[model samples]
Target chain A: MDISAVNALPYEDFVNIFGNVVEKCPLVSAAVWTRRPFVSLADLEAAINQFIDALPESGKEGILRCHPDLAGRDLHRGALTRESRQEQAGAGLDALRSDEASRVSRLNEEYKRRFGFPFVVCARAHDKASILRELSERCGNERAAERARGIQEVKKICRLRLQDLVRSDNKL
Target chain B: MDISAVNALPYEDFVNIFGNVVEKCPLVSAAVWTRRPFVSLADLEAAINQFIDALPESGKEGILRCHPDLAGRDLHRGALTRESRQEQAGAGLDALRSDEASRVSRLNEEYKRRFGFPFVVCARAHDKASILRELSERCGNERAAERARGIQEVKKICRLRLQDLVRSDNKL
Candidate 1:
């Protein structure tokens, strides 16, 4: 789809296509729809990034909390959202050996316990080994820094999702 | 768990146990944790209800949108959150015949197109037959009334989930 196709969507259509761009937070897309008629795909993305960046601490935490734990229950049970399933599989999370899975699970819990939100990374950007490494390192970060890091990862995930839906190379 | 147990919980534990009481909106639990030390289970529930009740229209719609459509893709894919999976099973949504499933999918799409959110009902409280009936009827409701109705059903689902977690009759 091109920017014109995106710009032409009704509110519901816009939301249906873009709602889960920010993980499970459709409210982001709903809010973004109000600022429509994007000059380019980048403008639309900036709108989303601005909305996320403008959120208060609790709101950002809420967005993070909405995310499923990496290689956790949902993935094991075949219950991941379509985007999440693909991303996790892309990172080889779906094929983790039992030992690796257990280690990831433990680190995920420890991360959440420390940060009050799951350790979120753009899974498609890293394999299981790298994900585990980052999860371990980030667990030691200050809460404020970790929170900032997680939100930035969310935006990375969003940019990829947006690219999947809209042809970024197409001129407005 | 009793009210005393609930009040005694650390914030992370509290959220872990009650975070999903409102379906996918852990933010409710996260926010409610700040107002802790409940006098009783009822008081905790009231805290949750009031937080939901106080949301602006967009917030309410976002909450509804978080819910999966009855007998929809998540159910078919075995991807529902555990709470949702059980509630849907209790309502016989898992056993829908092909025709019933198709009807539901069509109605769900139509409903979303019309209302900007999915059709939400407290599945544990209704069998598939009654759910279809309600879905058919509510499809015609004015947007404001339907939004209010969906939120109320969310509360009903919350109440049941709370009952599952904290015994309603146990004295504080």
Candidate 2:
């Protein structure tokens, strides 16, 4: 759909299409719908980012918590949301070797144990190797900084999802 | 796949195919793989059900917790697992009127708050109206009984999924 199409959506249809742009956080889409009549896809994304930025720490954590662990049990069980499954598969997470999967699983468990939420990464932007490297390095960071980093990844993911959903009208 | 094809699968392939028969509980699939060389579809289902039955209370609740709320935010967001999306859509959950959607959302929240897990009836078995009715009725039960009832529904869901995957072999 184009910018005009996006701008014309009813609240329900808008929320339905964009609700998961933030990966399981529909309220973000719902809130951003009020800022509609977007000039371009970028404007819609900005509204979403602004809403995310204005959230309290607890709310940000809640958003991060909604994400499934990359290549974790959910993937194994085929239980990930469709977007997540595709993203993880794109990152080569679905094909992890036994040893690699074991290592990732161990790191994921430890990361959650330390941070009180699963490690959040934009799998679409990283191959499994880089994902593992970042996960290991980030494990040593303090909680607050890691939360910020994770939310930034969430925005990156949101941007990619938005790009998929809304065609930018370059003619505008 | 037929019963013979199912019986011939490697552990990894087997798990990949049937892991979600229990909805985010790959452990059940992993455990049941040990009993393979299933004589028929019924035998394969029996193995899966036995694995679920063997779980302690917490494990069963854990399985229930893995399910998304029926016609809740995930559905609106298009974030449901593929199987769940199809089952919910088959139940006409995709077309709920605004008021029905709101009622389901409210009942879902209350059910979770009361039981500590989302209300999980197999969407394949009921249309939207019956789902709402059950959600209302089941809310009055104690946690223990609710957990058991939810698991039974999980088994019914598993049976349907298994039927889809493996054709029954009527001949010996």
Clashes per model (N, Cα, C within 3 A): 0, 0
Alpha carbon lDDT of residue B148, candidate 2?
Answer: 94
Q: Which residue pairs collide in model 1, if any? A: none
Q: Where does the lowest 10-residue lDDT sum fall in candidate 1 chain A? A: A163-172
> Model 2 over residues B1-172: C-alpha lDDT tens digits?
6788887765546656776777755546655665667888899888777766754454566567667789887888998887899999999999999999888888887887787677999888888889999999999999999989998999999999888766543311
How much is the lDDT of residue A1 in candidate 1?
Answer: 77
Candidate 2: tens digits of C-alpha lDDT, residues A9-51: 6554665577678776565675566566899888988887887
Model 2, residue B13: C-alpha shift (Å): 28
For every model in order, the fraction of real contacts preserved is 0.13, 0.00
Provide the fnat value for model 1, as a fraction from 0 to 1.
0.13
Residue B54, candidate 2: Cα error in Å is: 44
Could you give the DockQ of candidate 1? Answer: 0.17
Q: Write the per-residue lDDT of candidate 1 for residues A1-172, one digit (tens) a residue.
A: 7778888886656777888898777777766775778988899999888877765566677678778889988888998899999999999998999899889989998997787788999998888889999999999999989989999999999999899878543322
What is the TM-score of model 2 when looking only at chain B? 0.94
- TM per candidate comes to 0.64, 0.52
